[model samples]
Structure formats: C-alpha cells, structure tokens
Target: MAKKKVSKTIDDINRKIKEGKVVVVTADEMVGIVKKNGAEKAAQEVDVVTTGTFSPMCSSGAFINFGHTKPGIKASRTWLNDVPAYAGLAAVDCYMGATEPREDDPLNGVHPGQFKYGGGHVLHDLIAGKKVELRATSYGTDCYPETQVKKKITLSDLPYAMMLNPRNAYQNYNCAINLTKKTIYTYMGILKPNGGNANYATAGELSPLFNDPYYRTIGLGTRIFLGGAKGHVIAPGTQHNPNAERHENGIPLTPSGTLMVSGDMKEMDPRWVVGVSMLGYGCSLAVGLGIPIPILDAEMAEYTGVSD
Candidate 1:
C-alpha cells in the first residue's frame, strides 16, 4: 500500500477554525487581541475556540493569561456573549498512520493524533485571580476502538501521532480523562499546575495527574478530575454521561481495558474560547476561526508554534 500524506494546507487550517475546532493561541497573539481592542472587542472577533484533540486515546487545549490587571465586567460579558450556548461534544484523540496502509495492518506508522486542526483566540481582558474559572460546555463525539486485551491501559500507553492545521497553533489548555467510561474532559482555567518554575528538586510544586487509568468514568453525577487535583474535579451533577448506543457511525468503539490518555492544559498563559457567532447565529453554521492550532508533533517542538 502507498504511504498517506502527513502535511496539511492553509485551507484545511481555515476550515477547522471556522468549524470552531481550533482554540489554542500564542501569548503574543492573545495579548495583541486584547491590546488591539478591549476583551469584549476581541471576544466578538472570535469564532470557535479549538480545544485540543484526542485520537483513540490522547488530548490538549489552548491557554491564556490576564497579567496583573483584571478584565472589566463588561469585557467578561462580551467574552461570554461570544461563546456558544453549548460547546460541542468533546473530541477523542486517535492515532492516524503517516501513510495509508492495509486494513489488516492499520497501526503501522500511526502515532498520537489530535481531534481537529486550526488556530485559537485568547481572552486577556478577564480578571486574573486565584480560583477564577471559565465555564463553557463542550460537544463532540468519542471514538472508542474495540479492545483486543482484557487489561486496562492509560492513554499514555498507546502509540499515537498528530496532524497540525498550521493557522491556529498557539492555543493551549489543561486536559483530563475519564477512563472507565472512556471520555476526555477539557477546561479553561489558570495554568499553575501545567506551568510555573518548579524544578525536579522542588517538593511543594503542583503535580498534574496525566494518564492515570484509575480515574472514574463519564456519567451523570460523575466526578471528573482535572489536572490531578480533587478541587479541579467536575462534580457529577455538572455534566451527564454520553449515550453509548447513539454514537456516530464512523467512530470505532474499543472494549474494556482500553488505554485512554489525556494531555494537560498548560498554565503559563490564559486559554481562549474561539467564539463562532461572528459569522452566523446557528451552531450548525460553520465559520473560520483564524488562529494557528497545534497537534501532537511526531518530534516534540521546543514550544507549539505555527509552521511556516
């Protein structure tokens, strides 16, 4: 069989952004958005904030910061106004082969893959304070591959790859996973756990829990853990379990013991929710959110940035 192409184009990048699939943005770009216009003005310009993607097992999201000054209530309101009522379903990361291969040998060159591609926008106008939270509901389908083994594996255990949509590469976010039910969770918040100047010798640093398979499943009233902290866990009552039977046709369903991994949203900066309302009012209506997005690179880059 012939090898599949691994590179993407500018158009592909734009398409993902318009769809609200891209959400991470750079600190400079985010700061520019805020500086160009107050938070509300920047918020209105956004389309879809791309959270990170998970293939069969992994994920990431865009990040942001507010500096020392807090965004005003009006700016915060504008930020809220730009967001969709219900953020789409959470997307699961899957492994895509660098090249197309026979069905019998699909995993040949596959690596950690991201759910979608595109850029993201950040809201710097919001207040910067401890325990401040940004709330937004996510909507996307989960693709679970049937398991061949009986033992459970953390998403970090699987071999995976990434595909980048160059336009929106600066986005960042903290990530979590629900193993039992096989779901990925993302949140917009401060980046202390994922960021900071803690060295290996330090003891009091916040340690993030990534790829821990013992976490709970996704269900109504299920406690969703974010970045390894109990305080970050989303209470069971906040989100509901997805119906297993009504999954999209193309998504593969893995059996029990499947390894489900999630990426941690970085804390160095503030994250953005690319608002898709500028182009249209309907959720189904697609709009390009022009921001560079990142994917899990085969070879890790010094920092996630746009490809020239």
Candidate 2:
C-alpha cells in the first residue's frame, strides 16, 4: 500500500493567498465540512481553518511612550487616569499593566468587591478616544530638570503604543466547579456553592490551538485577529506548558500552551478589547483573538477537525 500524500505545501498556500484564491472557513464551518466529507477530502478542498476565542486575560497590558516633555522630565512614576504604571524605563516610556486598581478607588474600601476602575479601564478609555489624565514625576536631573508634569492625553498622542500581552488565549483550561458551601468569586467568574454552577473559559470548537494540537501551523510570528485588528504571535506565552495530559484525540485535559501576542493599540477596536472588573478578582482585559490554521495536509486536516 502506498502512503497518502499531501498535495499542497506552505508555499502553495502563499501563492494562493497572492492570487486571492485561497479557501477559508471558520472552525465551526470546518466541523460540518470535515464531518460530511471526512478529513481526507476536506484537506483536498479546504485551504484554511479560522478560529476565535474571547475571554478575560489577566496577563495583558500595553506599553506607551509619551514624547519627552518640555525641558525633558525623566518620568520616574507615572499614572494613566490615576492607575499606576511602571515608569522605570526611558524618559517618558512606561508599561501600563492591567489588574492594578486605581489608588483612589473609594468603593473597595467599604465593599471589598467594588473594584470599578483599574489599568484595564484606563487602556480601554484611551483607545476609546477619551482623553485620560497622564501624570508623571521626575527626580529633577541636570539634563532632564522637571519634577512633575500632568497633562490630558489620548492614545494617538503617544509616540508608540504597543499592545504587548505576555500571555493570552490559553489552550485547554480548567472548568471551575466550586465544591464549597457558599458563593465564590474567582477569575473564571462566580461559581455557586457545591457544584451549583460551573464556569469554563474557552471557545471549545472555535478555539485556535485545539485545531492544531501540535502547533504545526502556529508558531512565532503567526498572524492573528487581535482586538479586531491584525496581530502576531510574538512568543510562546508565559507558563506555556504544552506537555500535558491529552485525550485520545490530542486535546489537553487541562491548561496547556499559550501565546504572547502583540498589535497596534491604535488600530484596535474598543468593542473587541474590553475592560472587565470581576467580583473580588480585581480587573482584567477581555481580548478577542482569532487564528487562521493552514490545512497543509491530510494529517493537519484531521488535526483541524477539532478533536474536542
């Protein structure tokens, strides 16, 4: 018996992309397709499988480089809309990380769970074309002699605003089920007491990594849909543990691989990249990410069949 062959290659797909003749389908659409025609024939017919996932990602943030101020202030401490940002980098460069609640939040003091504003909200506001307060303090140097500077700034005002998230779009994550007696609030959202409710954070069939279990089509510099704009896989996300227990279908049983993604914050839409404040869980950004998996061969077609 002869071994089956994969008729197409990555270069072939690139040529099809150039010719605007590449076939594409959503992960959901591919399910029906592969189910009807089977993966072998599906491979012959399809060129790509698209996937999407939207969930709260705590390990998300952006880096903003505000232009040097008059007289050059070496910003030692910075805040965006009153949310503290790490300003230990260059003169006016800072990294605003989500999850840090505002210093002047007056709700959580009385109600322990009323965290309304945070770094995520500030980023959201900035992207929404809202002018946010940018305040910074310097130690007053000879070359950069400015102690304090405050101004209202928009996302466009910054020289560079890079949406560099360290970790996002977790592959196969946990299904939270509380076995205790009482409502519990967590990053996965609220879980009622004693298995009264279950919360899971994933798109299941529409998830990207599930379709390419071995990361064959996904790697460094893979293109993705980030915040409704074009983004790229910069690196394997933090805590990317791909060596996990998987089912017979090659899907992980627990949290597995992740992706570090980046895109231009200025090009992102506020609707797709949202700021969320979870009950008793601080703040996070709900990012919308999508990936297009190339169907390179029959094996990849079988893998893109969405094993779980």
User: Candidates' TM-scores?
Assistant: 0.18, 0.96
* Regions more than 4 Å wrong, model 2: 1-4, 106-108
User: What value does the lDDT take at residue 273 in candidate 2?
Assistant: 83
- The digit string of per-residue lDDT tens for model 2 on 1-308 reads 97576678888998999999999988888888888988889998899899999888889999999999888999999999889999989999999898888978764456448678888888889888999999999889999999999999999899999999999988888889999998877888888998998898889888888988879989999989999889999999999999989988788888999999999999999988888898866888888999999999887888778734
Q: Best TM-score goes to which candidate?
A: 2
Best by lDDT: 2
> What is the number of residue pairs that collide in model 2?
0
Task: Give the whole-model CA lDDT for all candidates, comma-separated.
Answer: 0.23, 0.89
What lDDT is obtained when candidate 2 is compared to the true structure?
A: 0.89
Write out the backbone clash pairs for model 2: none
| Per-residue alpha-carbon lDDT of candidate 1 for residues 46-128, written as tens digits (9 for 90 to 100) | 32222222111112222222111121111121112122111122222222111112123222133222212112221111111
